[model samples]
Target: MPEQYLKKILTSRVYDVARETALVRAPSLSRRTGHTVWLKREDEQDVFSFKIRGAYNKMAQLDADTLARGVVAASAGNHAQGVAMAAQRLKCQATIFMPVTTPAIKVSAVRNRAARVRLVGDSFDETLAAAQVFCEKNAQ
Candidate 1:
């Protein structure tokens, strides 16, 4: 598993969609703790989360045929937006399945990224199952 992660990190193409976030010192926190502290500004990303890096990297690694078959993910938060944005950038179709209880704003965000957003079950487990079924039926 460690070796697989190392290979993925070395081959990642995240920079195609994500910039290198800055690490800035936290002056107040450092002063209070009497130790140097730094903050990775992942929130500054286009998706406002580091999930974009992993999402883009995974898509980037896919072959042309796989990409053509499309991508699907189950998420309601930042991961949804990340996968949507990555699919748009790669010119691949993406289906994002979110729990029915997810807020409209999150769904809107994923849709804005040009992904097909589906409101599935009311919980994460249910949503995941729905996505899996979709993938199996679509051969994605």
Candidate 2:
């Protein structure tokens, strides 16, 4: 990675919304690989995914005007939850485009975070296209 970008990441305020999850010993994986191993306990997060770090960091860096205008995203599960969580923290509206086939649990999770949910197409690609079109139409 470039030095400038690395510095930005190092200085990120991602912790404002994201927890520093632990690295837990992974005995099973270690046994299989015949080496010591550890797994990041990202599932310990409120969103239950490490996806929240990136989502929160990206949103945190957005200009206030842009945040006021709201944010949009496309995802089938974790990423949607991450964005929704970040939106709630940042006090920004979020519209998440998800595939129609996405599980009800995940959809409910996004809504529970106060983000509007848009059930789009059957595949990730189609859902992404809908989100892109929405961004273009809204001039976001």
Candidate 3:
């Protein structure tokens, strides 16, 4: 990629994901599983998770035309907040779909990211389907 594009990628919304998240070697877990087990301590993320990386990367890679149309995604957990925050930083409209069963805390976090939040179905699968339909209809 060109320097400009590389810069965009490096400084993309995903960049906001803290690199400080730990990579802890877990000998106990490794022994239990009978294999090497290194925990990617995403639990330490600013939002207390790692799903934000994909969310930011995906949104940041959008072409100018796609961004003009906005973006939508379905997620019940960490992913929802990631997408919301990334969209907010990119100054693009974002719509998030989550199951009605999602915890209030997660819902509040997504809202904090400034994305339009919709509590749709009873399960993640149903929520995802609804979000996909919505995205397709909106050409997102």
My TM-score estimates for the predictions, one after another, are 0.89, 0.93, 0.79
| lDDT of the structure predicted as candidate 2 | 0.96
Ten contiguous residues minimizing lDDT sum, candidate 1: 8-17
- CA lDDT scores, all candidates in order: 0.93, 0.96, 0.83
Candidate that would win on lDDT: 2
Report the lDDT tens digits of candidate 1 across residue range 14-83. Answer: 9788988999999999999999999999999998999999999989999999999899999978999999
lDDT of 3 by residue, 57-92 (tens): 887788888877888888887988877877887888
Candidate 3, backbone clash total: 0
Off by over 4 Å in 1: 1-11, 32-34
Model 1 scores what on Cα lDDT? 0.93
Q: What is the lDDT of residue 13 in candidate 3?
A: 58
Output the lDDT of residue 12, model 2.
Answer: 92
Location of the lowest summed lDDT over 10 successive residues in candidate 2: 9-18
**What's the residue-level lDDT of 38 in candidate 2?**
93
Query: Which has the better TM-score: candidate 1, or candidate 2?
Result: 2
| Pairs that collide, model 3 | none
